[model samples]
Target: MIQKLQKKLEGKLPGIESWKRMAVKSGKGESIESESLQKYSDWISKDKLNDMRKAAVLIGLFKKNDEWCFSLIRRPMNEKNHPGQIALPGGAREKNENLMNTALREAFEEVGIKPEDVQIIGQLTPIPVPVSEYLIYPFVGVIDYEPEWVINEDEVEELFILRMSELISSDNGYTETWDLRGNKVEVPIFKVMNETVWGATAAVLSELIDIAK
Candidate 1:
């Protein structure tokens, strides 16, 4: 399965056009996105586009108990952004650093993934996160074996090993009403373990899932 996904990803990615339709288009003709991720239409407004910073995340895949799996982390609740949310290991790009290095570096800092241990296979669509003013690039990588994680307490609250097959097979998506800032809004999410994943992280994962299919 991993090899198949890697091969498909290498040739061509289902890019931003598909992602925009999936993320923002309201099947009901109601404006679900304008209330939430309206930036899917333009990534960022023209004026703020130039000011957006770059970030990257890793979808680190490995085999465990003869099954393919991937790693995810939950941020500490005290975090200023996306606190308590499950996410791919990643952070902002540093000065003079490339986005792929940002993904690998942040993965190492947050979860002890050695850069040499991962074979980067391909990348998914880059998504713009308006709330955080970030253009997030997501990379897919494979490691030969499951890792004994060394977690950074400052960045990670918990770690999860999710079965890649289960994610491919299960009904992982659902919607719920959330109070964002002050407005009551409906949000789409992926139910992973006991956690709810939404926003930019979910958007990235959604694209990954589509590619895996």
Candidate 2:
């Protein structure tokens, strides 16, 4: 199963065009909206998306114990933004860097995956975060072998490994109401590794799940 999944992913990634189509079907604006995170989309009307700071994150895949799996990180509670939130491995795009390079560099820095070891398959649609004012680009990549994770303590609280099967399973996706900034809002979330994954990270993963199916 692992090998087959690897081949399907590495053999022919759906790339940007597919992502654009999927974006229309399952991106932030379509599938990931919530009352609390709605502020993250408010910037759309300002026509200043290009002016937002750029960032990137990686959806990394690998085989573990004969099953196909992916990775996510829990941010440290003391961090300034999205502290203690579940997120993909990535960060701000540095000067003179493209989105792909930014994703690779940030993944290496936050999760200790060597850049050369990652085989980038394709990227998903870029989404905007109104709260942080960042335009985030998400890339999907695979490593042939299991990685030796050297987590950065300052940035990542711990790592979460989720099987693709679990992510795509209908049983794992559900909604719950939560108090956000004093307003009660219904949030769509995924149950992974016993953690509640919502917001932008969940939004990006939602697109990947649709593509895998």
Which candidate leads in lDDT?
1
Q: What digit string (tens of lDDT, one per residue) describes model 2 on residues 113-191?
A: 8889988877776777656878898888888887899899988999988998888883343767666666555666778
Task: Score candidate 1 by TM-score against the native.
Answer: 0.86
For model 1 the local lDDT of residue 105 reads: 98
TM-score of 2: 0.79
lDDT (CA) per prediction = 0.78, 0.74
**Backbone atom clashes (below 3 Å) for every candidate:** 0, 1
Q: Please provide the root mean square deviation of candidate 1 (C-alpha atoms, Å).
A: 3.2
Error of 2 at 184 (Å): 0.7
Residue 25, candidate 2: Cα error in Å is 18
**Cα misplacement distance, residue 135 of candidate 1 (Å):** 0.5
